[model samples]
Target: MLLELAGIDKQVGADTWLYPLNLTLQESAVTILLGATRAGKTSLMRIMAGLDTPTTGRVLVDGQDVTGVPVRRRNIAMVYQQFINYPSMTVADNIASPLRLSGQRDVLPRVREIARTLHIEEFLDRLPAELSGGQQQRVALARALAKDAPLMLLDEPLVNLDYKLREDLREELGDMFSQGRSTVVYATTEPAEALLLGGYTAVLDRGELLQYGPTIDVFQRPNSMRVARAFSDPPMNFIEARADGAALHCQGMGPVPLSGSNLPSGAVTLGLRAADLSLQHQGGDCLISGQVQLAEISGSATYVHAQTPVGNLIAQVPGVSHHQLGDAITLHFSSRQAYVFGPDESLLRAPQMEARHGSY
Candidate 1:
């Protein structure tokens, strides 16, 4: 099922919902719509599912234009952020509805199979309202899988779940998607979710399509500061710098030699992810001293906000590290691991692959 959006743009009255953009989804693979709230992910997904027609351009499926075609006429299935289910029907019946509608001879077996995979088999006889939020979402997913539609669209299905529930379901869904043949389009605002899904990703910002490629490729080598900022969690740190003949002169940090790339001598922005900064000094690392502004612990990681001579920066460290407000701290980072952005905010240099460690 090859899905293509050619010059797709949407507008409502005076405000624009989506800028004109083109995208071609790889058939039978998951393509994550990665962005923040109102990044045009849902609007774009609605257009793909035939729920809304683009003000301009066309929607193509397998080279055939399906623009303005009602969603009911297309072989598509969608799961939204909310847990949508038939209140009057049991979980078993909910999963079986699509199978029964498609005239499948073995509806019960198919329903049981999907229910078991989603861990909702135990709640098969119960109504959606009777189950917990996470359980109900599982039932919704089971129903979508049961449809066996060539195109499956999920708009942040796990967004409403608790943290632990979301973590568990994300892993389960990754495994499930790997085994399925459906062309999946899963939308999420979290970079970790996109990385966990480990497929193609399309990054969107303010209704504009910024970059599209393999999940890891886009993450490591963001074409612009906008993509980097959107893909980061605590947000990537930025420091103003100037490119000299063969090095970059960063404020407070001094000169850091450049290599393996050609960047014109002018003003540039240096980007470093919070995860890349370390508290301990390492060989060949540039050190910057600052006073701790705030320290927070979240899920086995400590985030330290510091006010440095150049700018404010955040460093993410492993485990529950203690730091007091107004405490002086020195952060270390390899210049080779930093990203250099030219005047226009385009990427001039990205860290070498080996320098980047661990997953998002």
Candidate 2:
């Protein structure tokens, strides 16, 4: 739909809700608003949906200014974290509401199709009150899809669903969006969800728009440390280091070779993804010795938290690895895997795209 927000910002009394920012959404594609709570994602989505007017700037759709347009006047659909539905209406009726409102003659066919896609067809005859939370949310989603709006906004629609249901719906929604023509704006705080959706992302922190680009590009090459932290799941690890004479030195850690690089001699922050650190050493990997503080197993992987001389670090190790508390452990990673951030907290150098992405 080619939605654009130019110089947009929001304020309430003496407090600011969103800092000044500009964004232009890619037409007919998903644009994820990726951020944590109070990161201005919901505020920005409300502005886009015409539910809230920006304190400053304009909301443009297809070259037309929609700054003061009310949501009811716009042909867009929205699904929120809470599943909203008519208490008296059956699931089928709820799904058909939009189609019937649009004067479509074959409401049943369209409703059934959407219900089937969302795996809610079995609950077609049930009322919202009679269905499970996950099932009710699917009905809400199905209704929005039936509206066939040019733009669709979902504000953490699956955030309230159970883990398995959320996982299932996320994949389903991704496939559905791919086949549809709607310009979708999905908001979530999950990096996994953003990665699974594989769309362009706009990373927000507090009230500021941090970075916006292709999801993979932004994930692999964060422009700054804040963006990196926002995109990482367990949070990217940072080590204080000094760059000097073709080498980087960390306190209590041996100097690592910084071959053929021109990183100005000064204090810098080295970032390492949790997945990059491993207990098993590979050739040319720098060793990091530490004592295990906690070992937590989640699904098929174990998250090992350790206290090292440099700092407290967490390593995401694959499979079920057994480790006791207070056990001395050594984690290893190639120096090339590190992300070098300047003293100003801006990314100075990122690992090669081929190596960083392909390693996993």
Candidate 3:
């Protein structure tokens, strides 16, 4: 492991910030810390970089305990959301700042190499004030890469960029990671970004580590309802239900046969993803009828928002459909695709359902 954090905890003022957190970043892999704002993503990055110390636990880098090491002495590079560059200095000089600060007298070649790799070579002679925001950020990244550190921490590096530039830079960063063994710990709240990077993703909520695993495993088999909701776009749909003998009863889809046991009597929330719900011409098993309230067309596919007896739900339909608002339609889903959550909102695995039916 390039970076390891064990039993980490922190507090500020009245709130207990980060809970007992543990994570490891492997060499040449990109580990994304995903969560919403104020989830302590930035705080954890700062702790790992040696800028801040936790009230408990230790931080190890390449088998060395560096919990008390100062930020300047740590061999780690951090690129923040804000473009930190000297307005008076040219791009080349800005990229060379870290090398110069480290007492490396001959730094021009390394600076040029990093600039070229990040595609900012042409803007080397331009000052920070003369370049665009994206260019300035590239300079910041170039500076970070120039250090050739063992670990790179990025805090929403593409926050301010337009969609096109963000996608381009994402690809560039992926390529850069492929060429080296540097460990990367990127923080973002976007689910698509986490899936695209393809590594271990730790979902943080209110400073606590909720779920951590491979991106595919976490997305396909979420440990809890909260983890499932956090990973989806519009989030998973929850319908209050009950188990009646071998069938499950809900307000929308009533009396669907249950494939598992150990269900409580009062109330249970059933979760289904948008992709799991589809429009069916003829009603089949596990079907629910609803009125389309809204329709969103996004080029290749259309998203239909319908008002069901349970609540408002979203369904992803392939290509453009003839469905319109106020239209009555039937939404279909398999029993296996439905997830059952306890009253406390934790996911409950149904082994019988898994064995009887396949996932969509």
Candidate 4:
């Protein structure tokens, strides 16, 4: 393992912040610390960067303990949600600062190289205050990249940028980091961004790690309801269900013939994602009847909100849709795309589909 956290715990006075946890980070892949606000994503990053001391446990690198080492001693480069740069320095100077401090010659050429990669070369002579938020962020990232540290950390660095800038920067950063030897750990609250990054993920909720695995596996097979809710966009829909012998039963939908292994008997909750449902019901699909309450058009996709017997549900459909308020329509999704949860909110089985999936 490149990096590992053994029995890590954080406590404040009488309150427990992070439960005793363990994590092993891959050497040369991006790892996303995924969760919502107040989920301890930032805290863990801070701890790993040596800005804070853990209440318990140790931090290790290359199988050796480096617990409580100061940030400067750990060859780590970090960028935060808020842009951090030398206020009085030009963008070029800012990017070259680290190189100069390390006694590297030909700093100007290297600075321009990084600036061009981040698309901030035009603003290289401007002070930090003169650039837009996105440009400032790009400068900060360029500075971090210029360092070429062994470990890289980004704490919601793109969150404050505009939508277009965020999308563009994310793509550029993904490409840049994947080709480097540095181990990268990025923190984000957006599940889509994590999926977009396409790496290993540590799912944190309320300071507790719910799951950790490859990005696609954790998203497709969330270990619990908390992980599912964190991994999904627009939230996942659920219905009370029960397993009897070989058939699974849902209210209003009646007893449906579903195929799966270890089908938990007794009370369970069935989880469904909006993207999995089809507006044009295809064969081998289970049906859910509902009245359309609203159709939200966002970009090229449409989100249909509906009131059903089970509860309020949302469906993500492609292209322009004609769904109207109070119009009754049936939503159908393949049984293989269904997610079943036990009474304890633990996943009973993952979605069984193997075809290409439309993500949220």
lDDT of 2 by residue, 299-343 (tens): 777999999999999999989999988999999988887888999
lDDT (10s digit) by residue, model 4, range 303-329: 999898878889989888987689999
* TM-score per model over all chains: 0.96, 0.96, 0.85, 0.95
Checking candidate 2 for backbone clashes, the offending pairs are none
**TM-score of model 3 (CA atoms):** 0.85
Model 1: what TM-score? 0.96
Show pairs that collide, candidate 3: none
Stretches off by above 4 angstroms in model 4 are: 260-262, 354-358
RMSD of each: 1.6, 1.7, 4.2, 1.8
Q: Using TM-score as the measure, name the better of candidate 2 and candidate 3.
A: 2
TM-score of 4: 0.95
* Clash totals in order: 0, 0, 0, 0
lDDT of 3 at 108: 85
| Pairs clashing within candidate 1 | none
Give stretches of model 2 more than 4 Å off. Answer: 354-360
List residue ranges in candidate 3 displaced over 4 A.
99-119, 244-247, 254-267, 280-285, 297-302, 318-325, 350-360
